[model samples]
Target chain A: MTRFRRPSAPSRLPLPPLAAQAAGFALTRLLRRIARRKPAILSRLGPHGGARFLIDLRDSPLLLLMEPGARRITAHPRRAVPRHDAAIRGRLPAFLAMLHGVEDGDALFFSGELEIAGDTSAVLALRNALDDAELDLTEELAAIPGRPFDGWLRRASGFAARQSGLALSRQEAMR
Target chain B: MMELVCPAGTPAALRAAVDAGAHAVYCGFADETNARNFPGLNFSRPELAEGIAYAAARGVRVLVAINTFPRAGDQAIWHRAVADAHAAGAHAVILADLGLIAHAAEAHPGLRLHLSVQAAAANPDAINLYAEAFGIRRVVLPRVLTVDEIAATNREIEVETEVFVFGGLCVMAEGRCSLSSWATGLSPNMNGVCSPASHVAYAEVGGHNEARLGGLLIHRTPKGAPVPYPTLCKGCFTAPATPSGPAQTGHLFEDPVSLDATELIPKLQKAGVTALKIEGRQRSRAYVAQVVRAFRAAVEAADAGAPMPAGLLAKLTEGQAATTGAYAKTWR
Candidate 1:
């Protein structure tokens, strides 16, 4: 199993200007939702100290979240960082080492492929929490038409086309 | 004629496969270069050289598998494996990682490159990307595509395609799954092991036996029933339901079934697959010999336009039943 690396920012493509702008706005909204849920989700992470982290996904924009004492959580969207939190970052494999070891409150940041923006320790706790949560939202996400903006980005970026080897058939893409 | 590639985890297995009529025998180094990084399996450098010599003497080819992705900053070890395999007279080196493939193609232009199944090159576009970017000569297609899809893919791609005909089946996309890593720190792409035996624990709970992998309760069965290994994807689990219904419990992803594409041999050959690979490098030498001989006979029958063989190794499956898997359209 290859460890997940935060995908680097895509090289600017020759996409239609409006489509690119729409993608940017859509990504921002998605990050905000993730940011808003950080505190509530972190609270369920059991007891752990806070850490600062960054999340860099290929389909989504960058995310920087901080949890202090595993209670208060702050999120910064689309911000550049000086350095990644190696302590938390170095343990990416360890975070994935076991499913149950992940907690919601631990702060984690993505860099390189993923960049971390702030403190390292708290981020690790948050990562643990997310892993422990047995949230099965696949069907729910499937129910809502276009609920996951990331899926839309994948479609827009031609990744989904690559998956099916055909243009999004109108029916499948709509569902 | 289409090639008959076979699996050989050990030097003894390699010789046995050759004797049993394998056109090419694929094996990996004793470390993480291969997916079947099981204890007491695979070949050392000298062992591999000797195996290649033995195969060459018998007019059989030896292909070395160094398919695992090279870790960041740890390219040297994987690169060295590629170099050593080439030096040992391997017919080709099977690879998966993008960087590693690039390294091998540039550094050893003379060596033939076959894409490992772990690359998950399921579509014509992905296969073309690999062929265009790395000059890969052959691709081991993922076990996710239907026969029709395989035929379509063969039409669109420039490289020869290989498909699995027997052995363990992966429900998820090959090389893309993180379930094993999520449960056990070791992953197939990184450590070359999935649901490693070391991390497995079985316990008696509530008068039933529960099989746990990396501390997650993956399987629970009545005391007398056969308990399956807690491979993350194939295990039973409960998923929370929506507001409209109660939670559901079962094999949400897939049941524990091994693939047997023997029945589809003619269709697969017509679909233009260049070779059929049997997936079991960790299997016993006897098992390897048995499967290779059976498959070789099957392929020859298909080539001769004869009827399919009967009673072909019924006792070798994990369970009494076998599935055509994603080779047939209904599997999707």
Candidate 2:
């Protein structure tokens, strides 16, 4: 049906503690922001809200750990990725594409663009939760209370997506 | 003309399928009453009613699937689902269990009934029996029938017939397989799951990606290679040595592949199929829309006596490989 034939060009993140911490802080804020706005996202996780997930960008130097129950996320060096109940590994764009609904998760996995291991049910629950949410991070960010930079951020997202070919927000009905 | 039936796992998917030109859309409730009972999938009672209304507004029929076998001690759950489906204005109810079918027939005689594929009714006799016994108006033919056999079966049956044209291919007889329960203690016919994701796990072992179901190794692939879900029937296995043959290690039952019979639309139409059904109720709205749109175009072309279109869904299938399966009897 829909074919994402473009290969995800490798983009490695800086492994320095400051960079990793900043990335983790940003993602953690994003998750909390969405959770506050759309409580159904976490509610959909059911019992898996507490499961630890390791998000490993294979080409990147840092990994992310997320706990929906605590509404928290942390970052670590790739070599020091912490213990987790489950892990999802993929290119950065692939992860974003799935998150933004620009690409189908099963299609991504079936095409070998992504890899998952351990406690598949948790991963499936998380996927379904995200699917139900129909999340668009750009929209969430633009909704921030004191953020007069919505227009600027939206413009920047468009520019970055065009330059790097990453899906930064939801793509509606590509088929 | 062959009706294009599509699957919808969620309300959004149901709307997408209808908008994409499905003649009918099939779905199930959120509980174990139907198959595809994955977490966060299927519809709630309110959602089903809304979805049915949405499709009905667009001239699309909604068929509720309550195909799982009823538990020995708890048949009310299944019975209530049929009643609710009829009450919610479903166009029909696809059922498998004989008792449940009978119950629906007697309790709601006006409700249209279609024999589910889970019933494994691939012959004219079985079809006619269901038709006579429970007033089945249609039979979703099992995937085991060849195109020729289908034509032959249609010659004797007096009801409409539906056939799966795409999606995950099951090697065992539908509804009759016990392989998943042996591995996971849950099955499709009962629990509406196979290799239930809860029992599956994957690990990185010595530069290979190993997938397991119920703690049993299903497959190991080199890193970056596509790894299939560890479905029991499609798992790689090793047969023990016997007097007549040495031990064998490989995909002994069936290869991991999805069915794509878009090219055979004309043949199936000629075989007297009333509908061309696309599988994957667990897939997303995007998938449902894409496949429904593609199949709708193909069905339209076939009905007009035009050449069937090429397979544009190769990238969307499992293992990126498509097969004709029993339709062509290529392997047999």
Candidate 3:
């Protein structure tokens, strides 16, 4: 009953080349920070550590390539999406909902809102690792080790989430 | 009123299930001790102990599932799981292997036992045998029984009976299927996974999403369509043409649909079922909470003598379709 609603309009977030590069850099930095704090997220991947995953946003032209073994993520245009072990295609809200534990990933996949291809096991391993780690992106990004910009990051994430109607942090009340 | 027995793959899921109104939650150690032995899933011993405490504090019981059959030479591994489960103050240990059950009964006489569905004790004789011999307090009936059959079996048995009301559907007889092993060389009964993700692959072939299990084509969906996880029993295949007929193509064994018996909660309660189990230990905590909440509402409505909630969890089913599976005797 608490399923995330599919956006009524076919609106896509616009990311120019420079914006995409900056977003990718921010994402990669955040992932590396998370990996350093929670090693189990990568360690639990076991043999699938080397698998590269593609986060294909169906409504957007941007794609995210995640290499857990290297603890890095890079953004690419849809046409330039590099070779990867697996790919998951969904809308931004769906991905954010799953990442924030606001919705079930399996339910989203089962409902036909998400599409996965290539190596299923690698994708599954990544999913399990993330689930086990229970990462809250907003919280992780905000804890910037001795940096005063932590507050600004939290504020920006909250503002972005509010403006876009996306869930970027764990909803404790829902849980 | 029937107890709501939910699944929790992690401590967080355990808390979610409890908060969502589960009467009990079942889990297993992060090894081959249970059927859902997937990577990055299940609990360590300390985590299990902590989860038990968390559930116990909330008045929700935690049942340890050591349901996988023991290997010939590695009985000790399964034995340690049972012992550790009891030591962690588990309400009961859900067991499948007869030898392992017997071992638990002998070694820890104080520990309560429940016959896992993997035992395939669909008949009253088998149920009674397990109850009398091993002092099993409950029996998780397999998915092969109809409501009338379950009622009849309950009439002939003395122990409590539990049934799966939701989640993945296993068309094969529980604990006896070898399709996964035939394809992957790894068995659910021995290694604790069926159609394991490690051996599964998905490919974009000719604008179709082709799902393969152990290198064998199982299902294919047109691009952008909902793709099912390539579980062997529910896979699509082409049966070679024979002299008698043309080749058959489709879900040869069973369709990739999940079991959603929520509407039958009243009937199952009338059938003398002691508990209703939701089967998704490999799922996320959000999923666990969502399902637990819905089932709790349905069970409450049933207990209050009210109509069951309509489509309480329609969106969460696999393939967005649900089946009563054998419980209604649909074939008949």
Alpha-carbon runs more than 4 Å astray in model 2: A1-18, A145-148, A173-175, B240-247
Candidate 1 local lDDT, residue A76: 30
The DockQ-derived docking category for candidate 3 is medium
Candidate 1, A1-175: lDDT as tens digits: 1234443444233344455356545545543444455433444332433333444333434333333343322323344442333222223332332222221111111111122223222333344234323222322233335656746654553564345333232211232
Candidate 2, residue B147: how far the Cα is off, in Å: 0.8
Q: Which CAPRI category fits model 2?
A: medium
Per-residue CA lDDT of model 2 for B69-182, tens digit only, reads: 999999999999999999999999999999999999999999999999999997888899999988999999999889999999999999999999999998678999999999
lDDT of 3 by residue, A34-85 (tens): 8898887776677889989998877666788999888888888765769988
User: What are the runs in model 3 whose C-alpha is more than 4 Å off?
Assistant: A1-21, A59-61, A77-80, A145-163, A173-175, B240-247
Worst 10 residues of 1 chain A by lDDT: A103-112
Candidate 2: RMSD to truth: 2.5
Instruction: Rank candidates by DockQ, best first.
Output: 2, 3, 1
Where does model 1 exceed 4 Å of error?
Answer: A1-175, B203-208, B239-247
TM-score of chain A of 1: 0.37
Q: Compared with the true structure, what per-residue lDDT tens digits does model 3 show for residues B1-332?
A: 78999999867788889989999999999899899888777888998999999999999999999999998999999999999999999999999999999999999999999999999998989999999988999999999999999999999999999999999998788999999999999888888999998788877899888888989998888876777888888988888999999999988777888899988999999999999999999888888988999999999999999998867676777777889998997832
Model 1, residue B296: distance off in Å is 1.2
Tens digit of per-residue lDDT, candidate 1, span B1-332:
56889988667568768988999999999788788776546777988999999999999999899988888888898999999999999999999999999999999999999999999988999999989988999999988889999999999999999989888888778888899999888899898988875576655579776778888998787754545656877789998998999999988677766788888999999999999898877554556667888989998999999887755654455433468888774653
